[model samples]
Target: MFEQIIAGIEGRIGGPARKVVVDRGVKPDNARHELGRHNPKVVIPLGREGIEMVAAGNPDVPVIAGAILHPSPSTARFHTTVTLNTDPLLLFGRLKSVAPATKRIIVIHDPNKSEGVIRAANDAAGQLGLDLTVIKVRDRRSAAWMYEAVFSSIDGSKDVVWLPTDTTTVDDTVILPLILEQSWKRSFPVISSTPSHMERGVLLALYPDYSKIGNALGSIAIDAVGGGARNGAVFSRQVQAAVNERTARHLGLKLSDDLRRQFDAVFPALAPLSR
Candidate 1:
């Protein structure tokens, strides 16, 4: 999907001739060989670390946009939306600190393949002394109905919407608009695993640094292609928490001074600029 988008943009710019090379996963040594086979002038790998590795090998090869896979290890590994058990616990802790009075937290679990996320959310809620309302969406493929049910369940109730790291929910067509609508109607805030959600309009995001992942990958790619000569290199990973100030303001939520300072990016509300 990203490759297609980049290709379209390149078509307009009359950029270098391009062809895509995809892999099942980002294993540093394996990716280097794959790119070597293609031997394209430029290789743009999705995920921060992948991009960095590629850049490390072929420093001269131009790398454009980078994809952020997982925001953090606790939340979920990037690309795969399945959340680890530790993710929900971290999320619950964050919620407890922010809205200690919160009693019922609504979680939408994908019925098809997210039993783990559901169980983890419930467990996290228990740890935080909160009641968990687990709503399982029967049709995991259709995000519209899943979101509709989530909003319907929380209507006229006091609850925070917890978004699990499920790929079925993260595609551009589904979760993004649902989040925007819920925020507009009820001032409800969303706690999510991906920082991209924060940029899109979610109230807060507690996840890893996606850009860092891309940068890491880029460096590795350069080295594998014999580019990073000056510096000794190794695989790198970094994690951090982030939030969107604009989304918080839109929902009339105030972020703690300490949190605001710690986040990687803070987007303001999009009301004035939308027009």
Candidate 2:
């Protein structure tokens, strides 16, 4: 991800780039050491520490960053943060395309962590003519109970469960397997934000397209450096889709060749028949 972002940065600037490695307990002088005597026009911080360093020392430069938690808005003229949160509008648009008959979208999330995502999902679902049922859970135990309740009641043909990017509510080891197993038994479609979940029996998954994200960051940086408009807290729009053909078969989805072409990855490749 860092490499791609660098490639994009250099591609836009048409020049060599300097990289500053930031880690825990690292001071601001380390950034200055890498930058030497020249002040950078833009600073792209990789982690939370990097952001702190920038805020403490070089608050004047335009900044663009990605893959961090709780990105605070900067007072700089151009501060763009590439959030890792999955865009619910884009996710639901894909769902509407693939599952046209889907009428209800069910999601279980931690209210504290996913209030923004749930609000966006509600708007997206309304626009797509899908009913949105958002169940909030405070802890993993409550999440499990909520999942069981939702799984038992939803109609397979009309309802699809959305697994958001919230790790608090969607514990991989505990909750994921339960959801997948119940989905197989109930024959309901399960869409995930994690791509590998498709291989583990999720009907469909949406994940970041790294190269596209890098390119976008690069473009934003270039524009920012050129005295363009400021962009704050931007969520990634470039996404790739994955589908499990075996799960599709189980869910009675007739995916044509054209539909298959839409997915970046498909699971369980068919083996050759015995000769």
Candidate 3:
């Protein structure tokens, strides 16, 4: 995705070849020197850390950071080539179509980590005419207690446990297994972020395809060069969906063959028979 994004920009803005800096692998000063050598019109940083390094190194250059959370006066916009999606409306709409009975969703996360996501989800839920329960946890231990509180006697028919991207909470190896196990025990459905989790048992998943992300970033770069986006920070427009057919079957998430076809990809394709 990083290479693709850079290529897209280069292809569009032909001239001097752009210098690539791997701040993670190299020293910060080396990266600064490499970046500071030229006062390029646009500085594209590939990751969260890269964004910080570029900002420090070239304070004057307009930076299109790939993973920074918000926008500032100096910062034009986020690259959006690759990152966890913060919007819930899209997922909610997908859930409504696939699982028609789902009326409410419960999401657990640490407020400091994903407060904006929670707020956005809540607002979107209202617009979608759905109920959203947000469970805020401080850390792994708090997440454990909150999980029990939220999922106790959860109604699988009309309720879903949304496993948003939360490193402080759901990223734990032990906690992940426990969450999956408990949901399975209660016949509850879960929506996950990672492809691995979708393959494991999560009913639905969202990801940004590199090609699609590149196209969006290319447009952003073009727009930035023009004047500026009114909205400083923008969500990535390119999002892809994957479904775990096996999990759907397990959870009885009824969908016609045609509706299932709507997904960009489906996990657990029909297994080949033994010869």
**CA-only RMSD, every prediction:** 10.4, 4.3, 4.6
Ranking of all predicted structures according to lDDT, beginning with the best and ending with the worst: 2, 3, 1
lDDT values, one for every candidate: 0.55, 0.76, 0.68
Instruction: Compose the digit string of candidate 3's lDDT tens values, residues 131-168.
Output: 99887778898888888887786899889998877787
Instruction: Name the lDDT value of residue 238 in candidate 2.
Output: 74
Which candidate has the top score in lDDT? 2
Task: Please state the error at residue 157 of candidate 2 in Å.
Answer: 0.9
Off by over 4 Å in 1: 1-86, 138-143, 153-157, 209-238, 271-275
Worst 10 residues of 3 by lDDT: 73-82
Task: Give the alpha carbon lDDT tens digit for every residue of 105-187 in model 2.
Answer: 89999977777668878998898888999898899999999998998787999899999888877887889888878887888
Pairs in clash, predicted candidate 3: none
CA error at residue 29 for candidate 2, angstroms = 7.3
Q: After superposition on all CA atoms, how large is the RMSD of candidate 2?
A: 4.3
Judged by lDDT against the true structure, how good is candidate 1?
0.55
Ranking by TM-score: 2, 3, 1
lDDT of 3: 0.68
